[model samples]
Target: MTEKNAYQQAGVDIKAGEQAVELMKDAVADTYTPNVLDGIGGFGAAYALGSNYKNPVLVSGADGVGTKLLLAIAADKHNTIGQDLVAMVANDILAQGAKPAFILDYLAVDKMRPEVVAEIVTGVAKAAKASGMALIGGESAELPGLYAKNHYDLAAFAVGVAEREQLLDPNNVAVGDVLIGLPSSGIHSNGYSLVRQVLGITTSERFKDLPIAMQETLLTPTKLYAQAVWPLVEQGFVQSMAHITGGGLTENLPRAYAKTLSAKINWGSWPILPIFNELQAAGDLSLEDMLLTFNNGLGMVLVVKSEDTQKVISQLSQTNQAAYIIGEMVNGQESGVVFEGDAPW
Candidate 1:
């Protein structure tokens, strides 16, 4: 056998990798814009900034799907995980009022499976397009001993640009500004480490007895808010924004505004989803811990002037998803977050 064949014998198949690229070509092409100067097979992706901004400030973010990948693999679900990978990072940059331009993803697998790779990349392309980004390039590798059989890890890096003069600043958030809560679809993409444990979601079991809605949500991808919130940012309707992730509202909301002020939250203002309540009861977890770990029904929070509250909510309503006036910004050097009403559960 030739050297190329020998490499395949060791489990890394060059021909299979080439096949995977071929399958994903059409999907990747769909996300390209005039700025995507080069296609796949390049050492680096070249995207032109062009004359889009008077002064362009680049914002970049990187994140993985976290332990959520374990559940997807266990259930043999590979599609939506790519979107989750994109959202985990894309939402972070979007929070700072950046317009997404391009993204690159990385996939590492135990074996060379072209079909699986194509499936994942297709999902990535779909999400990137929704976020108005060009999926310029990506990498997929096969390592024999590194990952377990049929297991892989996924991550992505995103870059966006905002006008230097228009970048959102927490300092711009006034004391009377209200917080608008964007409802999440179940857990989105965080706290799976606890969710998997409390619910007995093991590698061998796929929640057959669980309610169909809960079962489907376990692998649901994170929602990309670019479509709904970008217009608000462009119109200067927002002061600051927060993307709820690992630390939930407890940690994320504080970053949306100045450290000198605190957020006065009306706990019963919005309805917490049943998923959170179920997880809380199943794990016997306290409200504090639950709030810290999960998104608690709100995935993204925006700080807007009290006057713009209705306008923002009205605009967001067109998306057909509910947005709520859950809280307000206030003067308090004491704590970053202060709860007023009781949990609606």
Candidate 2:
């Protein structure tokens, strides 16, 4: 009997990795945009944002869906996580008033399952298309000993472009500006680690009894603001926008407020999603945790002048967007989001 070398015995298969890469070549190619200068496998991805817009400011952000991938694995649902990955990065930059131009992804797994890989990548492609960005490229590794079977980690990079004068900066925010909140697709990939810990439940179990519409809500693709808010921004109806993510409104909203101003969120004004109520009930999570962790339904926020608020809300509604006047900027020494009344939870 011949003894195998240490590398082979440990299950590190360079040939298999190469084969996996070869197998995904075509699907990868489908994601490329016109600005993509080269194919994958280079030391780095080369994208030319080249002379596309006048005085273009490059906005770039990188992020992962975090332990939300654990939920995807537990549910044996690979499709939606990819969209979550794109949202994590794209939305962050979109908060700065830029439009995503191209995206790159990174996938690391114990072993590659072609179907699962395809499902995840397909989500990325679909999301990129929805956001008007091209899924330029990505890397997938088959590391046998590093992860559990059916367990994988996903991340992405999104680059956007905005004119110098068009960028939304916190400095422009002022007192009396109104905050319009957009509804979030349930738990859009943040605070999941805490959620899982507190719920003491599996993703499949947590999602099982939900109505079809609600389950779909969990898997619903992220709401891309590039199209919804960009026109308003270009038309001068917006002061600044906040992309509600990891830190929730308790943290993110204040960042967009001036140091001398704060936001007062009217609890009755915004619609809270059912999933959030379920989480709070299941975990007995305090209001503080709820406000600081979960999105509590609001996703993206647009801070606009009081006079422009009604027009902006009308336009968003006409576009079939669920927009609400959730709060107003007020003069205060501290910058933070203050809930004005009791939440139904």
What residue pairs clash in candidate 2, if any at all? none
The CA lDDT at 341 in model 2 is: 82
Measured over all alpha carbons after superposition, the RMSD of each candidate to the real structure, in angstroms, is 1.7, 3.0
User: In candidate 1, what are the lDDT values of residues 152-200, reduced to their tens digit?
Assistant: 9999999999998778898998788999999887798899989988998
**Model 2 TM-score relative to the real fold:** 0.89
Model 2 regions lying over 4 Å from their true place: 1-30, 41-43, 202-221, 333-335
Who wins the TM-score comparison?
1
Report the error of model 1 at residue 3, Å.
Answer: 9.8
TM-score of 1: 0.96
Please give the lDDT score at residue 104 for candidate 1.
Answer: 95
Per-residue error at 341 for model 1, in Å? 1.1
